[model samples]
Target: MPKWRIGYRTLKTAIGAALSIFIAQLLQLDFYVSAGIITVLCISVTKKESVRASWERILACLVGLIYGSIVYELIGYHPISIALLFLLFIPTAVAIGAKRGVVTSVVIMLHLYTIEGVNVEVLINEILLIIIGVGVALIMNMYMPSNEKDLTWKQVRLEDCFRSIWKEFASYLRFGDNSWDGKEIADAAAFIEEGKEMALKNVDNHFLRNDDYFYHYFKMREKQFAVIKSILPFISTLDRTLIQGEKMASFMEELSQAVSPGNTSAYFLVRLNELRNELQQMELPQTREEFEVRSSLFYILHELEEYLLTKKKFKPDPKRTKTVSAKRLNRDHEQRDTK
Candidate 1:
């Protein structure tokens, strides 16, 4: 069973609709109820989307009014004229990237149809309705709830998944334990997708600046995850009894513990280079099986290096960190005061 809950968006939509209707009614506009419907349609998940949708609707409504008026007057203001009006209106709206506003514009066209023709008073009333409805939606969308906390939580979860995956890799290398169902890989991928989406929404919320640090961070993790997945087949093909596997397992365990929102890749890279050097200096394999296992281990190391290099180019967004810290401090203060 599913539960129904009123989220912030739903609340905003309700308030925006009511406010639009109230303003339209207060202004004595005809078809005031249509303003509420427009508000409902205009409210969007993100501020950017809301602004774009409002623009599209406004532009489409204008086009519909002009076109519908000409068509209605020329074609006798009959049902056939309306069909003719819509036949071109839809495609014209789409061409102008105002498809979202087609329905709203249709409402205006109907108002014109109801009045039998266009007039200054009715035109003003419809324009006022558009302005009031879209304005209310924009105002309601202005207070988009911050996604910083959600993004931060996702970042933490993604890092934890990475750590778990690395530990699983280490366990497999050290004990030949293939018991890990590789769930962390899937979980990390899901987290990265969710985080990227939320980060994009966060960026959309900020009009004056780019909040794309979290987005970049998630992208970096995505690259590293791909590398990790490539290393899996190599790991599974390895001979558990190989001495080289132990050293790689130890390195992976250390690397797993060091996963954080900081640049420690350089240290790991140095250690990895040293491990490669030590492997190069060792005695050559005595048989084909040993050579094959060593080759797979080498490939695993190469993939691990690629994984760290992906993170090497990434630097945490300091401004985002500070903003999040400030928000947390304010929240803490509020909690203390309430207590």
Candidate 2:
């Protein structure tokens, strides 16, 4: 048996539907049950979506009423006339971007069909049902739970995964062997995809302002993760340990520590450029194996530079990032050389 639990949407839909029926019956409206059905259709995951759906349904129902009045009055309320009305109304609904409202409109049209005539009082009754149903939906949708904490937690998990991936890369390059099971790469990929989808849902929930920071952040990480994947094959091919690999491992360790939400890529880019300079000044390769390993290491460095550049483009908040001084960079470079 499937696990069963009441979700927020389920609870909201049940309450909204009941409230709509109660209000419509209290007003002594015709077909009060239609109000409840409309509420069920109009409720959505976000306030903006619910309101938009309700508006489309209400507009479609009004259009249905107008079409039904003219068609039934002329076509004599026959079965063929209902069919004819649908053929004409469905296309009109699609043209007006109200295709989602077609079912609700059909319900209203059927109500007119049952009555066999349209009048001011009857039209008002149908309109009241629409109002009650849509009003209840909008009211119920006002209580969206905050997902900021959830988003933050996912962000932390994603960053931790990235940190672990880079730490493994460093360990492999330095020791040429490590017992890392390589699970972090898979975990990071999952987190990036899941985080992106949740961020998009968050954007939909916000009607006034765009909360797209997490979305952009995840996208940046996704690109960086791809680069990491490409770098991995090259890392695995290294059979000969070189001194440059040790320096590159140290750089990877620094990068792993900086896997965060802040835009510290500029600082790392500076260190990267210095490392490139240092590499170019080093003695030429004396053997084929040494040459291959050095070239692969350079390719990995190039991809890492691209990864940093991708993050730089995102430009996360300056307040969240630490400032790196020229003196500090020089001192770090000198210390690495002494090692």
Q: Top model by lDDT, which number?
A: 1
lDDT of 2 at 249: 85
lDDT of 1 at 115: 89
21-114 per-residue lDDT for model 2 (tens digits): 9999999999999999999999888877887898899889989999999999999888999999999999999999898899999999999999
Each candidate structure's TM-score, on Cα atoms with residue i matched to residue i, is: 0.92, 0.88
Estimate, for each residue in 151-210, the C-alpha lDDT of model 1 and write its tens digit: 987877788798899899889988988778888888999999999999899999988998
Q: Which run of 10 residues does model 1 get worst, by summed lDDT?
A: 320-329
Q: What TM-score does candidate 1 reach?
A: 0.92
- lDDT of model 2 at residue 108? 96
The 0-to-1 C-alpha lDDT of every candidate, in the order given, reads: 0.88, 0.86
Residue 63's lDDT in candidate 2: 95
